[model samples]
Target: MATEKLRQANTGIRSFWWWLQCIVSLLLTALLVMDRAEWIDVPGLQRLEWQAYDWRVRSTLDGQSDSSLAIIDIDERSLFEIGQWPWPRTTVAALIESLFTTYDADLLGVDIVFAEPEASHWQRHWENLVEEYPSLASLPPPTDGDQVLANTLSNYPVVLGYYFQSSVQAGDPPVIGQLPEQAHLTTDSLLSLPEPQRYTANLAILQNGALSAGFFDNPLVDADGVFRRVPMLQRWQGELYPGLPLAMLLALLGQPQIDPVIGEGSGVDQLEALDVGGFQIPVDADGSALVPWYGPRGHFEYISAADILEGRIEPGSLKGKILILGASAPGLMDLRSTPVGAVYPGPEINLGLLAGMLHQSFKAQPPWIQGFDLVNLCALGLIIVVIFPRLNAPLLMAVSGTLLLAAVGGNVWAWHQGWVLPVAGLVVLLLAQTLWHLSMNLLRETQQKRWVAEWFGQYVPPQLVKSMVESGESFGLEGEERELTVLFSDVRDFTAFSELLSPSELTRVMNRLLTPLTGAIHQHKGTIDKYMGDAVMAFWGAPLRDMKHADHAIEASFEMLAALERINREFVAEGKPTLAMGVGLNSGPMSVGNMGSGFRMAYTVMGDNVNLGSRLEGLTKVYGVSLIVSEATAKQAPDWCYRRLDQVRVKGRRAPLWILEPLGRWSTLSQERCTWHAAFETALDHYQAANFESAAQAFKELGEEDLTTQIYLARSEYFLKTPPPQNWDGVWMHTDK
Candidate 1:
C-alpha cells in the first residue's frame, strides 16, 4: 500500500515542495521543447516516434477501408492484356471514358502524369510510309491519339495528376504544360505555404482540356523515405494549387470557396488549417497532413483496369464511388514505401488522404500539442521530484515503473483521439530524473549507515544499533516470507472534522492522536509501516521476530484504543471535537521487505492477508465496531474474546473469510457479552440455513441497540419477506471498495 503523505500530494499543488517540483518540471519541459522547437527534432526521436506510430496503426486498423472509395488498378494482369504501360493513348482514353460513361463513377482521380503527348505505334509507322510513298498521302488520315485522350478528359469529371520538381537541369525549361488557374487557392489571407521550384504538369492541350488537376507529388515524405505525410497543397510563383486528393475533394464538394486560415500574432504567416464550407482540415504550416492508413495494401477494393475496358466488371457497380486511377505493376515504378507496406502502391497515399479528410479522421499535430505535452510533463515531473526523495529503493522502482507506464499509455490514448503527443521528451524527463535521484539516495544511505552511531541509538533498540555498529554489514533489507500479524487503523469520519479545523489545528490534532497510537504499537514491539493522515498501519514479525506476533498486535490495538479514549477526554474537556478509530488485524504468512523504488523504501508487509486486514478495517464502519480481525488472527491469539460477524468474500479474493470483532481479553470478558455472542451465533446459523423467520425473531430478542444485532436483524427481516434460492451458500459478496 502507498503511504498517506504521498496520497495527500495527489490532491493538488498545496506545498512548497510540490510547487518547486512544478517550477522545475516546467523549466525542464521548456528547455526540452526549445530543443525541439521547430521542424527539427532531437537526434533519432522523430524516427522512433515514426516507428511507434506505425506499430499503432498496424495494430488498430481492422483491415478495412471506406466503402465509398475504390482503386482502378493497372496491375500486372492489366499490363499483360493491354501490352505494357504507355499503351496507345486511345486505349487510355477508352479507360477514362468507361469510368464515367460506362460505370457512372462519382469522381475519378487519375494518378498518372502525361507531361508529353503520345503517338500510337500505327500512327508513327503510317507517318513513315507517308514520307516514303507519295500515294500514301491520299489514304485516309489516322486519328490523333493525344486529341482523343484530351477530348475524353474534357468530357468527364477527371482530376489528372502532375509531378513537381524541387530542381531541374540548368538548360531545360523550368515550367511545363498548363497549371490549374481557375480553381487556385482562394484565400484572401497571406500564408507561408510551401512553394516548389518547378513543376512537370500535363501536356498543355490535355491539361487545358481537363476538368481540373493537382500535383501527384508527395513532397513531405519522411527522412526514412516512407510516405507518412503528404502535402495537401503546394505553391509556385505565389500561386497555390491543391494536391491530388484535395483536388478530387474540391470537385466532390462542388468546388466550394477554399479558405486558408493563417495563424495570428506571429510574424511568420503560417497556414493553420483549410476550411471548405466549414469542413475544416487542420494542416501544418506547409500544408502537410498525416496519412490515415486503411491498413496494408488491398484494403481498398482493387478493380483491374482491363476489366473496365473489356466490360468484364459489373456495370454501374462503381457508380457514386470515388475511384483513384493508378497502377500497382512493379514495372510502372509508381510504388512507394509506406508504414503499412513496403511495396505499397503510391495511389493509396492520395486515396488515404482523401478518405480521411472526408471522415475527418486523420491524426494531427497542431500548434497547441506542444503546450499540452509541456503541461503533462510538468505534472509527471512534479510527482517524481516531490516523492522520489523520501521513498526507499524498493518503492522507487515500483513507483517509477508505474509512472512511466501511465505516461506512455496516456500518449497512446491521445493518439487514438486523433491528436499526436510526442512521448520522447516525457520519457527522457522521467528516466533521467529517476536515475539521478536513485543514485543520490544510495550515496546518502551509505553515508548515513557509516555514521549510524551518532543518531541511530535514539531511534532503534540499543542492541540492534550495537549489532549494526559492531558488525556494520550484519543486517540487510531483502525480501522474505514469514508468519506475521498485520494491522490497519483509521479514524472514523476524520474528513468531516478535519475540514472544520484550521490547517495548523488539524495538524496538531492529528499528531496528538497519531503520536500515542504509534507509541502503543511500539510498546507492543510493532513496526511502524507509514502514517496516512489520521490512519496508522503497523505490523509485528521480523526485522526482529516475535513468536507471539498475533498476541502483540492484538494487545497493541487495544492499547491504541485506550490511548485514543484519553485524547478524546482531553479534547472534550477543552471544548474540542473527538473522533473514534477502528482497527483490523490478520495473521498469516506474508511477504515482508524493504518495499519501494531505488530512491527510498520502508519495511512493509504485503500479501492477500495484509490486504484482507485493510479490507476488514474498512468494514468497521459497516459493522459499527472498533476492532475486527480475520479468523486466522483470532485463531492465532486464542486469549482474545471475539464476536463472529460474517463469512464472505472480500473484493479481490475468490474464497470466503470469517470476519470477527474482538471484544476484550478472554479473562476480562463479561457474562453478558458471552451470552449475547452465543445467542447471535445460533441466530446467524439459522439465517444461513434459510430459517429466516426464526432467525429474525431470535435477533429481535437480542435488542436493536446493539449495532451487530441490528445488522443481522435487518438482513433476517428482508430474507423472511423474500426467501433465498435453494442453492444459496449464505456468503455475502462485499463488492464495495
Candidate 2:
C-alpha cells in the first residue's frame, strides 16, 4: 500500500512534467508558424532562407540560355584596341551601325548610357578654334559629336538604357531623356510600387532619335548582396517606366497588349502577373521576377566590340539575334553578384532576363506563398508532437531524420516546379521539436531514476528498481497520459453478502476474496489503483511503463476469475454463499496520476475510457459474462479469443463503441466454445437485423440456461411485439453506468 502511494505521487509529477514539455513544443511551433505567415518577421531568417534557395538553384542548373540572345561585350581587349574610356562618338555610332547593318541584328539595347554629350577629336579641335576665335561659337562648334551619334540612332533599331538612383550627389547629372509614352502602364492606385528619386537618362536628342529607352537600374538586391531578381517597372513622380529587359521584350513582341493582373488579398491591389502580347509572366507583389539563370558566366556567346569595329567579326554571328552592348572590363564596374558567381557580368544578367522572356520561363515568389509555408510548418509540428511522444529513441531519430529529408526534398521539387517556397522555416521547426523531445527524454529519465532510488529502493525489490533505472524507465508515481489497459472487478450481489455478515466478518471475507486477486494483478505487472468495498480497480502501463499493457491486463483478469473460483469453493465449504466475480478490461489513452485532497491523495487513472471500464464491469450482470473487454484491448491481444458483445453508446459518450467478451487465450479455448461463439455471433446478428423469431430459435439452440442468450431471447420477443423503426442502426444506448 505504501509503495502504491509513492508510485502515485511520482506518476503525477512525471505526467505534469511531460505535458509542460508539450506546451513548450506547441509554443515554439506557433512562433515559427507566425513567422512563416508573415505576422511576425524573424531577423536573419530571410537571409538564411535565400542562402538555402541559392544552393538549390546553383546545384540544379541545366543547359545554357536560348541561342538567340548574345552579348556585345566591350571587354579589356576592346578598351586596349580602341583606346581608353569615352571613345569618339562616331566610333560608338559605328559600333551601333555595324550591329544593325553589317551583322543584321534584329534589335540592339545599349546598356551604356549617353547621359553626357561626347566630344570627338574634330569637335575638341573645333572647341580650341572657338577659344582662338569668338566667331566659332556661332559656327555650332563644327557640328558637335553628340549630333552625329544622335543621327545614327534615329535610323537604327537602337533602344538606349539608363539607370535610376535613390539619392543624389552634388555633381549628379540631371534627368536628361524624354521618356516615351505607353512604354509601361499601371493602374491608378499603385501605392506600393518602388519609386526612384532621380534618374540618369540619355541626352534628349539621343532619346528622341532612338526606337525607345529603358532604365537599366535593378533595385531588388537581396540581403545576401546577390542580384536574384529585377524590378519589371519603377515609379518616378507617379509615372511608370519599363525596365531594360522589359523594353527589349516589348520590342521583340511588338509591344503586344500589356495588361496587369490583380492578385487576391485585402483592400490592397497588387500586381500578380503581366500579360504581354498574350504571354502571361508571373511577378511578385513588388513586381519583381526571379532571374531565370540559364547557367554561369560564358553561358551566352559574346562578340568583342573591337572585333566588330575592326570588321573582323564573322558573318551571321549577330544575325537576327538581340544584342546587349555592355562593358565586361574590370574598370567598367558592371560586374554583379548573382547565383552563378559573385563577379558575373551585368550584361549577362540582362541577357538572361531577355532569354527567359523569349522562352516564357520564369520563377516567381508571389505573396500567397506565405500561406503555403505556414500550413507546412503547422502540419509538421502536429505530426512531430503526436508521434514523438510514443516512439523509442532509435525510432524517434529515424522518423525525424525521414521528415527532415522529406522537407528538403519536397522543397527542392517545388523549386524545380517553379515555386519559390521559404523552406527554412519548416526545417527550423522540425529541428526544434526533435531537439526538445530528445532533451526532455534525457531530463525525464534522469529525474525518474533519482526519484525511484531515493523513495522506492527500500519498498520495491532492488533488482526491480535497478532494472527500471538502468533501462531508463520512469518508475516515479507521477501521473502521465499513456495508452494503457484498465481493469475493474466486482463481486456479484455484494450488498446482500455484506448484510448477512457482521462488520468484522465482512472485512475478513472481503480480505479473503481480495488477497489472491491482488496477487494475480501484481504478478502480471499491474498497479492496484484503489479498492471500493467489494470492487477493485487496477491498471497496466503506469508506475512502470509496459508495452504489453493490454496483454498483461488480460492475463490478470483470467487469473482473478480463477482465484475467485477457489475463494468461492472455500466459502461454500464454510457454509457461506459463494460469490461470483465479473471483470472488465479496456485500453485507451488515460490520464494516470496521484489525485485527491492533500489529506488523502490516491494514485489513480482517470479518463472517459477509464469510466467506460467501470461501466463495463456493471454491465457484466446484464450480459451474464464473467469477463468483458473493449475492442481496443481485444485488438492489442489478438491471440485471445473473444465474442462480440454489443455496440453500445456508453453513458456520457455520444459515439457507440464495441465491447467483446474475452473468453481465454486462443490456445486455451475449447473447440466447443469456438462453435458456440460462431453460433452466438450469428444469433446476435439476426437479432440486430430484427429477425426476432429466427434469432430466438438460434439462441435456444446455443443454450437455454445461458443468461446472455436468454436476455437476447427476451429482447427478441419484446421487439417482435412492437417493431423498431427501420432507421434504427441497432446501437444500444445505455443511460446509466
Query: Model-by-model lDDT, in order?
Result: 0.80, 0.82
Least accurate 10 contiguous residues by lDDT in model 1 = 6-15
lDDT, residue 210, model 2 = 85
lDDT of 1 at 94: 96
TM-score of decoy 1 = 0.59
Q: Best candidate, lDDT-wise?
A: 2
Q: Write the per-residue lDDT of candidate 1 for residues 183-280, one digit (tens) a residue.
A: 54667355555667888888888887787898888767889999888777777776678889988888888888788877654355666778876677
Cα displacement (Å) at residue 647, model 2: 44
For candidate 2, what is the TM-score? 0.63
lDDT of 2 by residue, 1-737 (tens): 55466767777878887797788888888998878767898787788788887888898888756667889999999999999987888889888988888889989998988877765557677878888998868865455668888999998888889888867789877776556544545453542557877888888888888888778878879867899988888888767778888888887777765678887675656778877786767787777889988888989998899999999987667788888999999999999988889899988888888887778888878767866777788888888878886565567789999999999998888888888888888888888788888887767767776787665443333454556765655554556789999999999988998899999998898889888998898788787887888899999887677889999999999899999889888988999998888899999999986666657666688998898899898889878889989999999999998888888888878988888998778898899988888999999999888899999889888877788888888888888898889898878888878
